[model samples]
Target: MLRTILRREHKNRWERRAALVPESIAQLAAQKIPVAVEPCSIRAFPDEAYKAQGAELHNDLENFQLVLGIKEPPVASIAPQQVHLCFSHTIKGQPYNMGLLQKFIDQRATLIDYEPIVDERGVRTIAFGRFAGIAGAIDSFFVLGQKWLKMGKPTAYARIKQTKDYPSLSEIKSELAQLRVTNDKPLHVLIVGTGNVGKGAKEVCQWLGLPEVAIDEVLAQKAPKSSWFSVASARHLHERIGGGAFDYQEYLQLGKAQYRSIFDRLLGQFELLIQTPYWTDKYPAHLDIARMNENMQALPLVVGDISCDVNGSLKCTKKISTIDEPAYSYFVENDGIQDGIHADGISVMAIDNLPCELPVDASRHFSAILTRYVPELVKMDLNQTLTHSGLGKELQRAVIVYNGTVMPEFTYLQHYLDRHKLTKPSEAS
Candidate 1:
């Protein structure tokens, strides 16, 4: 029988999600595939749930050649030549996880990262992005309300609950339904990106009865004051430096086009900005710090850096905040950071793990997509090259490392590995 194992997530205590739900285990078992699950005390699903679904409870993983997890595994626990699947978070050669990447390479393990499982068009096939957007938007509003309260300007959002405080998205929308534009000035909201994250934010805005507006209308001061939101795509946020029109294809090529942000002009009009676009060094910063310093009053009162690429896309996002301590004040003048949004700076919410706040719903959504590929995973022959193997093409594309070597698609990470001295672990005496 094809044997597989599901390991417990020890990397993050707050991460209670599982890559495969117990129902998925039952489906795999019905196909004659044997599955085992490590005991987890804190996972959203209890250990008995897996047992009820025909999964064997066993800590012994030596017999299982394939292991699945939601997050990265501990370096010491990985067995050589095992097929490990999880969110390695190493595609970027992230400094913090270089050691973990090195351990995978040294152990001759095969790693299939979840984040890179994209379609031919590069859209992620599976992710927690939707929930992240939902939680992020909710948290952004909470921060905005708290900041207003601190300024002695109470708003309708003061009665709204934090993202984690809500039992479900339905309850969240229910509370938002109660929110009315009671303030003299209608709160203007700007949402960047039209992907899943942006859609989530837009849903909340619409639930609150906020009408959508155009950039030109907002700039012309014709935008509605009490309850309105404006959505901007890549073209609206950036343009060529020399008054040239923004070309999507040209922008994809990093050095071919010189682009600068036009976000500053739109900043002053909106009370809040929810940024959800994927950002890299190639793109211009959404909110240029130097430009913001020149016109502090023009900036939005609150910025929800939902993408949360610290110091990558959003210049003001210098730190990765936690769910417990989600917001901070980013001072543009001296580039200083404070605990809350005081009079000295603008409020920023850049929580890295937004989906954790809505784990139950997120896990169900994630597992549904994941279960579809299990048949291919259980029957795949590891003897053949991954490219030639029966592993689904989607899974094949996501394999960053195989048998102690980086794949051609991920060769770019080699420079990072070399820079970080990712040498093989020394043989113990």
Candidate 2:
């Protein structure tokens, strides 16, 4: 039997989600797989719940060979030769997590990143993206209400509560269903992307009884009596630098090399912008500081950056907001960031871990999918080479580091490691 332990999340106080729920533990127990759980005071599922499912509550995870967590673990906690599964967040050569990656390499550990765990079609099999979108939209509305109130123009948004304040998703939907926006001034919302995140945001919009309109309708027509939303794809936001027809496939192959953002042209049309697209530095930003400064009067009153990629898609998202302090103002005139909604500048809500606000729901959804793969994950022998290992294609492709060495497919990260000068412990000595 493989020894596995569910580690407690320590990223922030708001991160109370569990990678494995009590039901998952019970399922593992039926298979005679004994599981351990670290005691966490604030976890959505308490220690007693895990204990009831025959899980041993232990502070030390040294005895456990396989450890599972939702987020990246701290560098000081990693042990030598352990098999760890988590969202490493270093695949993109993220400067912040390079030290954590270096620790894993030095310890000769096997790392399985959840971000790349995909099916044959390259679609992610397990993720909290949907919940992120759900909570993001909820919080975005709350921010808008507060922003409008601060600006001395209170609206129906003020009635919406923060996601954490709601007990369940049903309650949130009920509240939204009853909401009535009778303000004479029209409210227009624009959503970006069409993936799970976008769907989640759209679900919230539907609950609020907001009619979905086309981008052309949004740009050409006057704002309707009631609030309405429009969704935009990559083609709608970006165009060829020389003004040719937009070819999405070609744009994907050659990112910023040929594309320039046309999103600014539609800036004056919407009062709120909910961003949910997957973005990187290679893509043109939806709104840059220079463009924002130039079009301050046309800028949206609120920007809900659900995809919270720092300095990535929307350059105004200079930093990740916390659940405790979820809203901030971005002043384009001075390129300054001020906490909370101010009369000047746009109110920005960019919580990186939005799902954390609804821990119970997010954990339940995530654990259900993760439980299906736990058995196969624990059975794999980490001593063997990745090629020889019996892991299925999904798991195999998800391994970013095996036995302290960067996997061949992820060797590009070596360049970042070298640039950061993250030498091994022995090398440093």
Candidate 3:
């Protein structure tokens, strides 16, 4: 049997989530698969919990052949011929994680990224997206409350607290259920995307007893009795650049060449905008810098970017906020950011790891899905070609790197690696 270890997450103090939990460890133990866990003080599950499930507590994982983590591991940690499973965050050639990807190549290691582990339909089989949405929605309200209070205008949102402050998701929902918007000025919220993240955000809105209104209704309402929200999909946010109707398939295939964003025009209609969409440079940005500079006054009071892609869809998301400091004010005039809410400019909540705010819940949910794949992952032979490695289509498709070589499907990343090498100080000098 292959030796496996659940590595500790050290990316941030707030990253307390685990790829696997005690319950899954117990299942593996029942099958005679010995599991090792690195001692972590801040992990949602205590070391003793894993120990109870017959997991070995180890500090050094050098002996472990298979390593599992929730995020990208440190560059120094990659060992030759080892298999690593984690959210590598390098699928899109993310510049910040390019070094980490290169480390995997240099060490002759195999990298299986969880982000691309999808079914035949190309939908991700396992992800923290729903939890991200839930925490993001909660924090959005919290930010809105804080921003309003700073501006000397208190609303029902003022009573909401940050997602991390709550002990559990149930408690957060219960508290939100009690909040009542007594002010006559109805709050209109716009949620972008109708995926898992959007559904989770909508769940929070429903807890607040907010009705789902049409975008037309939101635009027509001069004064409303209660707070309401509307959801928008790609069709709602974009249009054909030329004189034609929006075609989703065409936009997906041609991206920016065929479509353009109209999201900026709708910003002023909502007090809050909770964005939860996937974006790449190929697509039109929801709010480009030029549009943002021109329409600063039309910006929403609070933008809860659950997608949290810095400078992705929403250009105002200049940087990713952390759990400790979950918000920043984007100054339109100077194109500067000031930590926390302020009276001037828009308050943006752009925490990249929103799921980490509810670590316990997020871990359990993730572990449940990931446990199904562990048995197969540990049993695979790294020496063989990926096609003959016995991994199912989902896992096979996720193998970005196989023994120092980038998979044929992901050869485009080589361009990014070459670009990084050219830009390196040593090469440039």
Query: TM-score for each prediction?
Result: 0.93, 0.94, 0.95
State each candidate's clash count.
Answer: 2, 0, 0
Give the poorly placed runs of model 1, Cα more than 4 Å off.
181-185, 219-221, 255-257, 341-344, 422-429
The whole-model C-alpha lDDT of candidate 2 against the native structure comes to 0.87
| Highest-lDDT candidate | 3
Ranked by TM-score, the better of candidates 1 and 2 is 2
Q: Show pairs that collide, candidate 3.
A: none
Off by over 4 Å in 3: 182-185, 216-225, 425-429
Q: Over 4 Å off in model 2, which ranges?
A: 182-185, 219-225, 422-429
Q: Candidate 3's residue-wise lDDT over 1-429, tens digit each?
A: 569999999998889999999999998888878789999999999999999888989988777889999899988889888889999989888877888899889989899999889888889889998998899998998999888889888778888989999999899878877776534347878999999999999999998888888765644545254678898888877889876888888989999898888776576678899999888889999787788888877788899998888888887899999898999998778778998889777899999989999999999999999889988998998778999987988999999999999999999999999878777767548
On lDDT, the stronger of 2 and 3 is 3
Worst 10 residues of 1 by lDDT: 420-429
lDDT of 1 by residue, 71-171 (tens): 88888777787778899989878866777787878988788899989888988989998888888988998898888888888878777677888888788
Candidate 2 colliding pairs: none
Instruction: Estimate the TM-score for candidate 1.
Output: 0.93
- Write down the lDDT that model 1 would get: 0.82
Q: Write the per-residue lDDT of candidate 2 for residues 383-416, one digit (tens) a residue.
A: 6788777688899999988889988899999899
Worst 10 residues of 3 by lDDT: 216-225
